[model samples]
Target: MKQFFRLMAALFLSLVLSLAGLAPPAAARGKAPERIPTILISIDGFRPDYISPALTPNLAAIAAKGVSGTMTPSFPTITFPNHWTLATGLRPDRHGVINGAMSDPAHPGVIFGKSSEQPWWWDGSGGPVHVEPIWVAAERAHIRSGIMFWPGSTTAIDGIRASDWQAYHADLPNHERAEVVLDWMRRPANIRPGLALLYFGDVDVNGHRHGPGSPETTAAIRDVDAAIGYLRRGLAGMHRQVNLVIVSDHGMAHTIPDHVIWLKDYVAKEDYALVSYGGILFINNVPGHEAKLAESLKKMPAFIHCWGKGELPERFHYGRNPRVPDWLCLPDPGARIMDGNPEHPNDGGDHGYDPASPDMRALFLATGPAFRSGTHLPVFDNVSIEPLLRRLIGLAPGKDRDGTVAPVEKALR
Candidate 1:
């Protein structure tokens, strides 16, 4: 009876030790551990204040595990432009994505017809990036990278692309997106991507359809929070180390129907071809109409402001690129601008105002072996993300970037 009991105890101990990989050393045990993979995620329209412990428990937990703080987005505070900033560490002006939709005489099509969704325009098929994005830099260094649905992911920038990439798709579920990225991370080390990016558009979609504080938008926020939690769990289960970074393009703002400013009310339709969305629009005008529209905009300075390409605000760092419009029309805070019957049917929420506005504050959080736990960093500009990302992936940053390393480096462990 004593021998039987001792044998049972020994069997249980061996099983536990084997599962823990502590029973004995294997031949591969002496090999160096793999360089940790880096996963960067973007949640569009995510506000810094949205990470309430009661509601966004997963994200809150991540903040507690690592670093969390405000990430100020670049001006115009729109989608494609700011996403590019995160990737390239260049402002919209320097990156040459001045607006989501605009007419580039060098690559002219229908400005309004394909404003925001034109992959060909952004993907280097029409016009290429002025600065090297980190993905391209990673590829240059012979490191494999993958990106899913990130703005410009489809762009083979300067004849280089992330080894694996997928363009934007509205119908893909968030969990499925996670699965696809995880599969890429699971590849053999010789071929596996060291840097991967994923984007979530659901919160932005709901934020547009419903105001930022609306119950529907809150539910969307919760959905995003849960997706992040699910992705974290899935990676944790893999028993490998991956550095995770969560970022947002910009936040949302409330608006009223009374705030709509129709372009036709100030100038005739033929004066300029307009690409309109809430907050701002690019004006491509007939040569003579440009001056006339400028005068009209001057008269309505209180309601709106227009700047010729040369006269744009210096702080914005816009207007030098040829792809930018002949004139820019900016609306006051809480106001919406439209060329015709509301360019988008969205009624309550809008962005693209001034980045200085508190309403446009974005979110940033990171948790992984690369980051320091229990650290809450100060607010940093979104452009600074590039240098930090390059460091996290163990790559050198491109020289052309305006982003300095001081802002985001403190997040490192």
Candidate 2:
């Protein structure tokens, strides 16, 4: 009878300690640790230099505790392309989001837009094919994902959307976005998302309107930092093991009104259809006028460089996609390429520049049980991010991924 009472007492004590989180974790008892949740946070148009203890304390704190580095964005250094690259481990050329706006020959009169969720716009399923994104891969592996306004998240890539997703709403406040992610994180383990994405676009917006160095952009940075602090607090309260990976699609560069390059000034509007314009210009030649258009572009100022579709610099790894127009023209750093004259020719800042430009480098900071503490890594291509994410979520690197885990594996424990 005494032995039975002692056994009961011991069991009761164990239950109490476990309930209080004071007992040895499963790992201590020779069981593997629970799967660590992975959260990817994107700060659009964020440059590595933008992070400092005074400007972004929360991000600074995370950097001090984990891995921090700069990521070279895919060629064109545009938001949509680099985001897709980070999510798919494929370059803009391979992933098909070659530019923020592009046209496909099969879809006549249809130009890809920001809010378009058509799988064809992403994977060319309406034409070329579907290249899977990370969320789709996660779902395929039986892992749930919560996507909060990531580009392509709402779309049915591989005929699968994330288990939970919110449509892109530019009006949505940053804190509210963080709250949605926290709510998702709070779900019971059985239903909780193993992989999630949170995106904040205010920095990009402000950077476009007020320049990367403007006070307005600085305020936006602070606002995002506060939201990060809120998310960190929420995660701590939940006592959930999470790997938080913060990144940016591309960095911003200052642009002035005089810096704008008017496309019509170099090429006749009648000779080609301008599919897209900005720092990079995509022009589809009018039938039978290709040679004339090519000849005219040769007179372009030294600031702009034009290339026939398949003839782009091999280093860019672009122009092969049919969606990329016949002629691709890239302007010098800090210059804008406009299809036509606009009342406001210049924004305060812009991306879409050469990825090699210093101002176009994106941000990378990661912290969690899966990462080495206080680690700083060299600049790596943004494509490598997807492989790292796959590793974090316990997924195997499948076939045809452009990024290798080698660049980022050093930051892992």
Candidate 3:
């Protein structure tokens, strides 16, 4: 009887010890959930105020279940530079793509595209960007990646796998673009894109064609919301886990026709080549005309701020990239730089502006295991995004690039 009791006690002790060993560590057990297979959806011109219960039920639902905030994109507040900054977690000066259209005086062969046929200026070769993108980081971590229409993604970087990509063509329909992404997700090899980026340009296009607050722009937002709904439903059916981050490159503002500033009127067209987006203008001079043109632009009005390339505001951090033009001009909100070409009139909405303008604030929302419920962060910069993504994918940081800013701690449960 004594021997049998001792054997039973020993067995009980072993069972207790095993159960204790199996218990998760206190920190891990208390740790908030982590999301898997993150998906970043870029709604080209999404504005945070555009989200309403009536306008975007799907996005609102996400807000109810996850976190949302205003993400400030990089300086000049243009598309390509902001998107590249978001991808690499570096400022435009570091990433090299300074504007939608870049002019390289040093290497005349390096020209940015205004049309689809032009080669991508951000071919990862220009000295603009020094860090590897999140896709490259993820791939190095052995994670698969997929991209659709993210501006700087056309030229494949080493270690990253983009199943498909397209040259910048504003002519493509948004639905068709969505269909391509949906189809790519269905492919057996792409069953779960460890990281996926989807871009929708309709809102931005319509906003530029009309105005940001126009009826046409509102309708376009609804269409984009519906498309997002479709993508969410499709992902649900896949029975795979995912983290979906919805963001915008920048916001739009209405520009009055009377508010247009035609640089050609102030400076000889032959003296300066005008490159502009929204109200921000770049003046590239023909040799000796730089000083005269800069002086001429300064006396116009307080509504516009003019600075020589080397003297640009310290906040802009703009001059390091060779693509930046010789002189930078920033107009007040509700103003724009008109194209000198009379054939193309200056009408509609636009984005490029001082990053401080509320109109320039981009949208950011995350839904997945890693995010907390119904959270809101007051504000964050776009450069903070790349670092957050790198952490989720477990990748090492690149040299010389600013590491990820503090994670949206409030956004995670």
Candidate 4:
């Protein structure tokens, strides 16, 4: 009996040893290394095709050593909506940021961004973001975050902790923006944020000012590229092993000056107010005139489609956001929405169209220890970005949402 007991004990010991061998290492026990200390850089209005040996050397170098692909922004393909979508990992409908300007039919005086004091924009201070952003998720997990000029970040969310953030401003120089980001990364507390978002607006601004592919746009792209190069070198000098994910809100297309559409021309100015940005036009018509204005916009030559607040394209996934206008008009590719008044001339290029258009498809590049080198993945929804960011920072998403969008696994080394 004693010999039998010894044999049983030995067997148990062997099984325990085997199980321990299969267990994950201490560093690898929780999440993939590729998911930590991630940096997402947004170069506004960056087109995938803009990446060439001639135009963007630094981006090319990163792409050569990492993964590159087209990342489709959320529907309506505008900046504010897509940028918010990227942070929330929810469709515009879910997040309620349908467009740059939105009108709340339920609340008589509620208009987002029509005037500075309007309470229409997402109130991060107390309001709930249907899906928690990676920043909030990271903060919940005791991780620090840093955001520089990312839209929607200016409004502080309840649980999200960011070292610093700024409201969206097209006028901020690219180099100055980079410097701010680097300073945040170098914070003495080793506050090198687990997640850092850097945005460069020159490309989009120049694209709107001089038209995409024009000399001014090209120069802006080069200038931003050089800034990125500086950032890359700076990060390396700091010996930070970060996963850099470069992305763009949307791309631009040249618009013919003659094809401009002025909403006031087709609708009574008294009944409707036009809120325009990034080539998206939102007409807030008086309650009774909503239908008439919608119809007129549909018949307009420059507009590709017009929809009532709830009838925006299924693909747009907008309408639900508090910021979406009551009546949304999408101009076709290479079209501009402008006031026909002689004072306001139609010039430059724009992007607020369907994101699927190649012209609106943006650039996405990922590099670092977490990303596989020299690879390309199929296009993905911009909303998937939040999930990847959460994983990198070792945090869980706030809400259990439709999990259709996941991290870019292909980018993992």
The best candidate by lDDT is 2
How displaced is residue 160 in candidate 3, in Å?
A: 5.3
Taking all chains together, each candidate's TM-score versus the true structure is 0.87, 0.90, 0.84, 0.82
- Candidate 3 local lDDT, 1-413, one digit each (tens): 99999999999999999998999879768955433677788888788889998988988888777888998778888888888888888888777778887766656755676442233355445574445667767766666777877876766565344645566566676666666666666766435467778788889888888878789999999988888888778767876467678899999888767778776667777678766644688768778886777678877667888777778887777786767788888888778766655432467787888888999899999888777788888788888888777665656655566546475866764
- Ranked by TM-score, the better of candidates 1 and 4 is 1
Q: Candidate 1 — which residues are off by over 4 angstroms?
A: 1-29, 108-130, 343-346
On residues 15-112, what C-alpha lDDT tens digit does candidate 4 reach at each position?
A: 99999999987877885442347789998899989998889999988778788888877777877777877777776666666666665555666556
Between candidates 3 and 4, the one scoring higher on TM-score is 3
Candidate 3 overall Cα lDDT vs. reference? 0.75
The alpha-carbon RMSD values of the candidates against the true structure, listed in the order shown, are 9.7, 6.4, 6.6, 6.9
Best by TM-score: 2
Q: Order of all candidates by TM-score, from best down to worst?
A: 2, 1, 3, 4
- What lDDT would each prediction earn against the true structure? 0.80, 0.88, 0.75, 0.73
Where is model 4 poorest over a 10-residue stretch in terms of lDDT? 118-127
Say which prediction, candidate 2 or candidate 4, comes out ahead on TM-score: 2
**lDDT-based ranking, best first?**
2, 1, 3, 4
Clashes by residue pair, model 4 = 35-392, 96-321, 96-322, 97-321, 102-323, 102-324
lDDT of 2 by residue, 179-228 (tens): 99999989988789999999999999899888888999999999999999
**Ten residues in sequence with the least summed lDDT for candidate 3:** 114-123
